[model samples]
Target: MENELTLKRFVDIRRNLGYTQVEFAKVLDIRNTTADIERGRTKLSGKVVAELLKQFKINPLWLFGESEMQYLEPSKTSVIPKVVTVDSSDNENMVLVNAKAAAGYPQNIQDTSWYKQLPAFDLPLPEFRNATYRGFQVEGDSMLPNLKPGEWVLAKAVEDIAHVSPNKIYVIVLEDAVLVKKIEKAPNSNNVTLISLNDSYPPYRIEPQQIQEIWQVNSKITFGVDATTEKGLLRQLQESMEELKNQFNHGKS
Candidate 1:
């Protein structure tokens, strides 16, 4: 059964790309669902083969089991050197990088001694457990309301460039500087688009080779807020709003 073997190879391709049936379906732009096709309820179409070639460069010969190679060209995946510090109990601690340290981070990233010297502490949060994380202090207004200056962002290391999801915020480590921005991958290209949330800034494209490392932003820790002053401001705003409402009602009456 040549057709059965082809179907099996097709399933293998999806698995190698780290996609589930549902995700593979979306990538293939399949209307009948990949689960149905995989189960032999629906036939795999020629369009799928062409799309796979265009997007991922899946080899037709390989898909049909004629060749041993899976892709015409190897997928471009980056392996970032992750250096983590462990506590006395053998648990990994999240490293803290201030503005000064962040500038030099790209150069010293691979050095174990350099990483150990940076401030490291165990974050008790369950979400950050069992993963290498780093806290970067936000510096600029590029991200605006979403991320503020002096706030610390906890991010997880993204090992592969292929795994960078579109429209997600990441701390991109470059040779010159480390930047925090939203990422968008250009289709069929090695260039990635960086978008700044602040309208004053414009989107820019950078080659994958220019990036040293990428970190997916998980959460932010904000400081320097006076809670009492904030509460008082809120009360004043509420009183002003009520006064405006009373004036409007009086005029109507």
Candidate 2:
């Protein structure tokens, strides 16, 4: 029989704890074989599962798919806040919207079609629970290490413009485009500066009236490699390519 504690579930559980495969493997004191285990190509050695439960307070039943709850109880040393799906009574809803949601968000914010069609899930972060939240498929690397293309950012709706904080990430609505960028309060002006985390992309200033809606990005679900790591690799590759190009040009000269 296929193991209920499949590799996919293991990766999902690690992501829930905000740890990467390498980091989680380090915590478990496993030697350099976490990728295989996370890929389900291998299983834990004897006593490894017991050590994992002891170190991370993981619920064995939950890990093995025998239970729905994630953790047996709070770990005394755990500084991370525990999260669970919203109970059945509250109807906590979060719909994952497509990249086009940015362009159509203002129009479809009240519509049920997109909300119903997209994949939705619930989270229990108290600071964000009060607001209407949705997942937006982001694109472009302008935000760099903060937000990346093909990732879904969980954004909470901001009905009032005054509530936006300076230098915080926001999903801003425009007539033709929807963008995720940092907001910088301008000096004695009605406009706010939209900034990108990647320095290559320059900052832009726009009038608040141009903004149709605003949403605060609270969390993100990423696929493939982490953005920070990917960016570093890209930067290295770019530098190498430039050097190689320069050498070729010098040789030709």
Which of the numbered candidates is closest to the native, going by highest TM-score?
1
Give the per-residue lDDT digits (tens) of candidate 2, residues 44-86: 5546667667776666666677777566454222211111123
Candidate 2 vs. true structure, TM-score = 0.48
Cα-based lDDT at residue 18, candidate 1: 95
Off by over 4 Å in 2: 1-90, 100-103, 124-128, 224-253
Positional deviation of residue 185's Cα in model 1 after best superposition, in angstroms: 0.6
The CA lDDT of each predicted structure is: 0.77, 0.64
**Which model scores highest in lDDT?**
1
| Candidate 1 lDDT over residue span 1-253, tens digit each | 2388788988888898999888889989987458877777777678988998889888787888777767765544453645778889988887778777888898997888887656665655445676788778888899998999877787899977877887688999987889999988878877888999998999999878778888999777664443124354234334543565576678779
- Please list the residue runs of candidate 1 whose C-alpha ends up more than 4 Å from where it truly belongs after superposition: 1-81, 225-253
Q: Quote the RMSD, in angstroms, for model 1.
A: 14.0
- The whole-model C-alpha lDDT of candidate 1 against the native structure comes to 0.77
Tell me the lDDT of model 1 at 242: 56
Residue 104, model 1: Cα distance from true site in angstroms: 0.5
